[model samples]
Target: MCFDAIDMRVFDELRKLEMFFKEETRRGCSIIDLYELVQHAGNILPRLYLLCTVGSVYIKSKEAPAKDVLKDLVEMCRGIQHPVRGLFLRSYLSQVSRDKLPDIGSEYEGDADTVMDAVEFVLQNFTEMNKLWVRMQHQGPAREKEKREKGRSELRDLVGKNLHVLSQIEGVDLDMYKDTVLPRVLEQVVNCKDELAQFYLMDCIIQVFPDEYHLQTLEVLLGACPQLQPSVDIKTVLSRLMERLSNYAASSAEVLPEFLQVEAFSKLNNVIGKVIEAQVDMPIFGAVTLYSSLLTFTLHVHPDRLDYADQVLGACVKKLSSKGKLEDSRATKQIVALLSAPLEKYNDVVTALKLSNYHHVMEYLDNETNKIMATVIIQSIMKNNTRISTADKVEALFELITGLIKDLDGNHEEVDEDDFKEEQNSVARLIQMLHNDDPVEMYKIICTVRRQFMTGGPKRLPFTIPPLVFSSLKLVRRLQGQDEGQDENPFGDESLTTPKKIFQLLNQTIEVLSTVPAPELALQLYLQCAEAANDSDLEPVAYEFFTQAYILYEEEVSDSKAQVTALHLIIGTLRRMHVFGVENRDTLTHKATGYSAKLLKKPDQCRAVYSCAHLFWVDDQDNMKDGERVLICLKRALRIANAAQQMSNATRGILFLREGEPQVTAAAIQSLIELINTEMQSDSSTPDPAADAFFASTLRYIQFQKQKGGAIGERVYVLMFLGKRNVENLSAYWFTTKSFTTNLMV
Candidate 1:
């Protein structure tokens, strides 16, 4: 380690100190070893440290080899072959070469201070040392000798230079090895005694390294100011520096990597935590700006940190929702508009809430409900396939609905069902909008999510209000202008786009749910391991979900229908769940052996469940496809519904299940069948959904009959056939002939 010009000046000044140490040593070894140590340390100190560290800065290039100046060391080097001599010899050689040594003992700790004092003493030796230090700096360090000295300009230059280099190296596999460079920079940034050194090194680091490096640095920053850790003034200064770092990265996003941008967001969270630690309520604006910049950086990074990013953004949505709720119309509008836009664009909201001042976002961003809607949309997106877990998405949605129900405490008249129904439709559209990419497990998740809304409520009969709550029957009324609800139907007018948030949230949630590996893991483990188990020896955990759906139909037919409609959900979910593996064929068996008898019984249940599991098939013609599939499911549901109603004990659960599936085909079929039966003046034990399902299935059967040239009265049941058509709704004939041709005389 050779000295730079300034370092050499320090040494030259130390040479002058040679006279002082020599002059003082002969005076009487006043401080004992201090005098002897000083005598030897003059050369040893710089040789070990300043030379080892700052010395590297003076090198013109990395290619240079060591320039050994001492000839007398040759004999000592040769004699180092001796064991004891080698130990002292190696230490002496290292001490002489770089003048820097590790902390070998308490003596080393005591002497390091002597090195700094030595450095200071040399600085005081000549006014020239000051000039030399300035010369070494591109522009002089900040002139505060008593405290932190900074050189923002030089630091900025280093950042720009490396930042450029990193950009150029974006995806390049430059063989440039930097494994040690970051740690070196870390120490330099953390431990720079000189304020100027500290500031410049950090500035250089933030600028030069890629965004990933910044994120890496932030993880270390978590260690910066631990809650109960002992720290020094350096720690204090470093913490302040961190306050500015995210903002600095935020300044020019091109230098920020997605990972760094994400970490900057996390940093905002950390900052919030810090504020809590400090017990500071109502943080300042610069802090807000810093947090906002992190958001700005994230939008630039795109989908990379979206999951963690959503956590931060979600806090704001909650805030804006509150503001919207308090009837702060402006806040409601702003929050809604912000939420309505693509989340990738909302920097302000992101920043404002990153620190967790959720109350403000709620109060200031938008109406609480609207904001909640936005949160649901966004969080739903995050909780969607790509962002989170099925169970989590389910839990999140359930939590969301529960929260809304808790908030809607006012006593409105019975007419307000429109409002409740409208909310339900919004939820319905969100649920129904599930695409092929959506996981089948999501059905169970959705069921589980809205299970609370399916029944239980404080105002209504246990859970009855939930069914009414999600039912869109009243909402369709409101859409026709029959009632003035707080919100409008999102799907009524083609001219009006779906709330961007609603759709995006759906998209995102699907995206997140798609990423959940655990369910997939469970699936994989079940699929692979269950194949090896004997049906009689298997435990329910081995593949319970796989077999659960089958038990419904079999049990419904045999007469133990505890719930009428629940079997439909189990079946629907099974159909959807089987999709991702529709092409895979495996031996139907338990996933594990040596299970409880309760789990292994009903061996046929597994085959029954899987047989209908592949029912909900999603294809390009999504609407038509869903309708067709749903129609079929309705028929299947009719059997279950009929079984439940007939069993007498099944009505309770069927009632619960009915509200959950507002669009159940069996329900619609039953509606049509009841109308038909009234016209026919027929008496029956009760409305049979299985019969309704048969009635609905015959729509296609009638079409098939027509294709085969059969007459109206030539089918299986003449009374069930359409003999004449009547267009009851005046608006119907103008739109389509189907309703006009099929509405009467069955």
Candidate 2:
């Protein structure tokens, strides 16, 4: 009959059988009555199910013959010839007899035939189920192949259940399990030669059996791997087995040591080694994936077994080496993924692996492969262990690091530009892991890392080296005992415990960064060190680092915006140097004006020189004592300001005027007037020729703009303040620019 019609009739008969069993049990019927009723059934399906139900009842009786009943049940299940019907019938028999079967323990002194018959019965049922499952694939029409495959997939559990029963059977010792049971079960798996059957049944065996049994017969199970169908994913199978073994070691760690003393791990390694060598047709990715699984298992079982990890890595290396010129295929990616897995506590695993392979594994792969492996190695070091205290561990770790950054080979003529970015990122992560309590040791490690970046590649150094320097500076600051919660004193504490060493490292780091071409970064690093030094009362060191910043600004950098930024930075840095005595103060102030006069833009020069004029005089402390020096700076600023205004007028007559040039010129004029007003507010008593001449040049410039019909209202106020301070000295200038005063009052 077709399966659809049989399914309906079977369920109807099943419902009727369920009702009949309940009635008969309520009437206290004997086991013999049910058995006789089962024997008299008319069809094949109902008869098998009824026989199983009766056998279960008979086994429940104290005086029933379990061996004979089990024997009768197994024989009756074979009566159904329809593949689906026979498979379901065997499924019913296995399920019903699960808890009802006799316990044939080791003390079974009864007839040995009984135990053998029961074993034979289960083996017989398993064998029939396999035949039925395999045969169902061919029973349907050829066009329904997909449909047949789906149905078979759903029925796979019925085939695997017989194995679970055999495993649960009472008196099956290691010898019987190895000699009789395993061989018979594997015969069905191998003899079927179906991919789905092989994969599913192998998985079931790995999961259903005890770890001790698998350990005892590890060789046989792994040897059976070769007999699997060619299309099956043997990697997945081996991975599952390895996972089971690992979990066994984890849970039963205390007592299972005896079984796994030295024998289990060696056997496992040997088995995987043979598998890797024997699977000549296996893809490199599959073999590497299996090795990765084994690596995890080895670490779990015996983490101290470093040699086994090497052996596994060696197998991967050999496989990767055999493949010629790996493309960017899935196989290559899988190999990289396997290499990236954390076999030990983070970077230590990577460090050990790299050390073991020396340069062979790293150089054997493509650039992308090496890049990925290097990234994962550095990341693992960052994430795994933070207890990097000793010199040996740090040395080994940084040796691997140096190789990752630069090449072991001295050839970089045709380097891949893409990998350098990933390497740069890896360097960032490497630095993050160096926050050790021992700053001196950390400083040494950072210097090594810094030197690697310096010599790693010249092209990426500008973009990469600054972050390492900054991280080093942060380490220095931390070592010098600065706190975020406290008020920021640019002169860090003079009584710092480690000031000498801190200044030494900070100075060395900044000096090295000065050689790189990143001007803005260099400026910031030097400023940071200078501020830190000044805070610590190391005046000479502070002045030296600050001078290094000026050197970069003057000689190395050419961007006008950067130069302007540096000028402003110098002024801000010098404003805090009020603690310097007279000679040192004069030296820094002189350098400040020198940098100001060296600005490339006229507007930037005018603004910066006027800004630096404050350093020469102390208003609150000395009552405009150096006002004559301030006036001389303003005189130079006015010349630059007038020159800048003339340049703007020149652009205005041509076709070269930019969008915001006039507004910038007007703002510079306003800034110059504000500087004069500041001097008038502070030095109302100093009689200096330079101040009078500078104010008169400014008044004529405002009059020139007023003659061109431009508004000079803010500049006019500077005239009013200067006139209020010295009306007799500026009467002629006020009349020369009379319209500015008129426009201001109006």
Candidate 3:
């Protein structure tokens, strides 16, 4: 069928003839005969040489001699069967490595580098071989079947035989399996159940891969678990996922989730109380995401929802106050922080309260039940007492004050919307049962308070604690010591509504008036002192009361503009009883001829000077000429206007309106009108381009004419645009003066 086969058959017949010859010689075949027999065996010799190399290593460890022998076999196979057998031998030798051949010495022909080069050569050759064989397999219809069968058989032999041999090279690795062989095998097994070779591949992966790559290699090899393996199940998947989770958790960043906090029970909120109350079961990733979501809600949710806020904060407080292992540690710190957060961000709380009209929450507070009540009272007092409006803010503070006291008196129920309202009913009835002067009842009422004083501060109890209640009791003790007077005990008299209790109550209030900044404290104290006065009591102390009232009046004048204006108006009205009327203003007028002149030198400063303007009196008259008034008084003012004093735009403008009206002083009015027209025409002087200001003022003046078209009224208004034009004018145009103007200008 082939030349080599024919040669082999002829050679076999010759071998029988040669055997007869060898039998006669009674010895093995000579070297020449053996050489000739192996000459055509070059194509097959590479396989023999490789086997010998491996055998050498197995027999002698790394010290075996294999290189020189393999090189000599390579040369001996060269040109043995034209290019066919020679090329095959050379290709095979390329894969035979000396380093893997027992590390024998220089005597070993090839080294590890030789093995590497051989791998490259053989891999490329295999590619070429595949191309050639595949071409034969599909060459044509006539030869395709025979060619493919032969090609496949040859390929199988080449792969199975040489793969393990190449694997023995000292540095040769299994890339052929990974990049080539295994991929093909994997594709084949996608639908195939014959998994023995696949198992072999996986087992080799375990042995051949490094520890770092072993698990990952198994993962890749498993692909998507085509079907669950008997050994590997969902639990196995879960186990790996858990290990991955642990690896992720080793990071110490704040990326932990809210669900992880040991005490966190729910969501965070803008409310100081609720923010301190959230809880979580166990730590996880994404705390930043949850925290930011909470922040977003806080920023956007309406702050004025007090009822909603109370519900949320109340729930939070209840949750945190639940008994727990963390009660002594995180709970205490969190509570302190919550209390401080309100004070730190009190502006937002104030704004929210104002928006919701929930100021009553701050007003009627009591420290007896709630720990935060004192701060609330302080802030409320500060906010309300500093205000200056007709609004009745003091009502809230009063309700808080006396309401707490009323609730403390036994039989009171609702506690007036202050702290712990439900329990007040029980306390109120118990309080009524006690003897009015019983000290034991007071002690019971005081039990809920933690401390009476601020830390590191004054020894006296805070005024917010309703110190009047304590001071009243204390004053009673002092009065009992004052003299052994025969008067029935003032504070403890058992008669219904005892006079002593009333006196002590007044005295208690007097002490508080001395301390807390109640908005009505001064007025209430004044009333008290007035009632308590006796005929012979030092009159000067009443003077002191007057002095205090005077001081309060001054403070209000400076602190509140509306009150100052009202006070000035009241003083003016009172002065109308004595001095200020039209009669007085007439007497101070200046005399002049041709035009009886009247002038207010600077009416803008006149408000300050008019503190005494009411000292002059005048009676109303229908007819008046005030020209002489300005002529005398403004003689000096005119000199000052020309020299020292620079009149304000308002003052100058008013002067032009009064004196410069042609009906008053025609020459002066004509001169100003000429000057105004001159300025309007000048372009180089950068005459104001606010030409509309002129037109607007003109239109208005025309509207205000006395005759409904009076030329004089138009002139009066037109004079106002002097020194200012259009939008640039910031001066007031109208004045509510007592006098109309000079001459017949009215």
Candidate 4:
């Protein structure tokens, strides 16, 4: 058993003896005999202990003054001088005489026996107990110091209980706690010159007292923090005190005025500053933890004072500035938490961004930790759905998260591909959330985002740029809508405010992204911008967008399949565009057809050329319908298909064309039927059960016409018969001759 447990058992027996004496007194027996036992006791320890027990009952009997009895008992018990025994003996006296202390309105209260006597009793016992506790450390041999310290730690609560008793006294109001209670406690705690005692007792003082008492005497309590042994964790001690007061201030709104009245925050801030300054060897983790606690307190007590929060962050930054980059994990983790506190408090990253030193603090984190913090910041912005409404704010927000946006200096580690992508994706999502109601200002925001994302290098461009592109397009539409009926342009600068200018900016951004060689995404964004331009009736701008897309296709899109996809997208975009004049339209269409015919594979060329046939035949718009040109394009597609079949026969040794051959053949047949109906105006087209049968009969008709030679028949014969050897299975094709003939004739 520990010494305290054994002492408790001994005290239990002493308790029985006192109860026996009380019963005798009730029966009118002479309790005076207890004093005789005190004098005649074999050991001074027991003698003084017996005197204290009997003195308690004597005071209750009112035979002598309570103050006199308590004073004599406390004075007489000092004779033992053995640290452990004396501490427990005093502990026994305090425990037994707790209720009988002559305090206000107590049963033992009278003229000399007042609350002062009670306060004196507890404070004196506390002072003596702390003395004995500190003395325990020096009594043992030097080598056994750790063992003695362990024993002392077990008995610490005995000394701390005295403070607890002082707190429990009803008469110890704020004035008493301030003037007498706290000062006396702090005096002993500082004078102990022992690290363990100073740490434990300081924490005891903060915890055992009410927060209001601490606040009222903030200076005195914080004044003693730096006077302790340098090894003490003053940060943890101060943190606890601040946490208590913060909670106290948060308990109700009515208490906040009192907090401000006493300048609690300033006092605490000053003291923490002094403590950090005094403890020159304090670890960065300890320093940051201290600031984090202060920040939490500031957020609670002074929720509206953003300057206070910023001051705390700025202080943290100053502390970290001299330490270089924080390489220690524990310190970095603490810094991350410190930086995140305001983000969580305001629940808006923009509010955190308002603090000038927020990003300054983040600069101390290593690369990986920096990215994690950046991710957290982004998640907060997204979670709150806060719209970054100004270009400056957007710029600041991106600057704060620059770690996630780009590679930091000296970061040589190979980034995990998936993790990097996810972080960039989060930044991308954040981009979508940035908006401004003013179109001009919104344009500035896009420009700001573009400038920021441009530094992310090629890898991040694919993820970060598209959102800005889309956002720019959205702003374009808004500006176009606002420009409808106003005499003056709703947008400000002619260079920047017009929808065309925004498209111009988008084109430039996509051009940068194209250098990343992300042709597919670049192409798609270009097309979208083009379509938006078309909608705005900005014909020149729309044509420029298409021209950029085609340029990217020819230069950047190299793989055969990608070329096929790019060419088709171009054709689709061009087919829908009505803004292009005849010259521009023909130029772009010719480029599309030229690139299609130059594909790496003949089959790709064949499909691309046939798809391009739609560009020349815009049925919906009356401006660009050249049926003869359409016939020439289909005839070119058939020729490409025929060449592809011949190549396949020579190289792969296959009988029929590849996957695209059937579509080519079907397109040619439909175009031929259209041409015949347009000239001859015949309605003999009917659905046939077999496509091969209809195809053979058409060839026979063309062949018979070839013998009797007409210009139309010659053209149709050449278009149909060019790829005749490539048709292995007409039934296998997705399109059938019957459906094509029937639909075309109608």
Question: What residue runs in model 1 are displaced by over 4 Å at the alpha carbon?
Answer: 1-204, 210-396, 401-425, 431-746
Please state the error at residue 570 of candidate 2 in Å: 4.1
Candidate 2: where is the Cα deviation over 4 Å? 1-12, 18-64, 76-82, 104-117, 136-148, 170-180, 255-259, 324-426, 435-447, 455-459, 470-517, 523-552, 570-591, 598-603, 614-631, 634-746
lDDT: worst 10-residue window of model 1: 651-660
Pairs in clash, predicted candidate 4: none
> What lDDT is reached at residue 252 by model 1?
68
Query: What range of 10 consecutive residues in model 3 has the weakest lDDT sum?
Result: 589-598
lDDT of 3 at 675: 51
**Candidate 2 residue-wise lDDT, 610-632, digit = tens:** 66655755434453236457656
Top-lDDT structure, candidate number:
4
- Whichever of 2 and 4 has more TM-score, that candidate is 4
What C-alpha lDDT does candidate 2 achieve relative to the native structure? 0.66
Residues 426-532 of candidate 3: C-alpha lDDT, one tens digit per residue = 22322222122443333322221212111102212232233333333343343332222224332344433322433434444444444444323443343333223
Instruction: Encode model 4's per-residue lDDT on 263-294: one tens digit a residue.
Output: 88888889889988999999988999999999
Candidate 4 clashes: the total is 0
Please, what are the lDDT tens digits per residue for candidate 1 over residues 1-746?
A: 32234444654554455445445546764433442243343544333332322222211111122221122222224332332223223333332333221112312224223332222211121112122222343332456532212323322332223223332332222122133334433443444333454444445444445544545555554443332222222223333444355455556666566445455556646654464345233222222333343444444444354555455455545433432434434334444433333343442323323333333343343223642664455444434332333544445433434434433344233535655555444544444332222333433343354444433243322223222222222222222322222224221223221222122222222223223312232222223222222121222222343442233233322332322223333333332322222222122212111110112212222212222322332333232223333334334433443444344322211110121233433455356545455533444334445434434444555455557775322211211221112112212321332212342223
Q: What's model 4's overall lDDT?
A: 0.78
Give the C-alpha lDDT of model 1.
Answer: 0.34
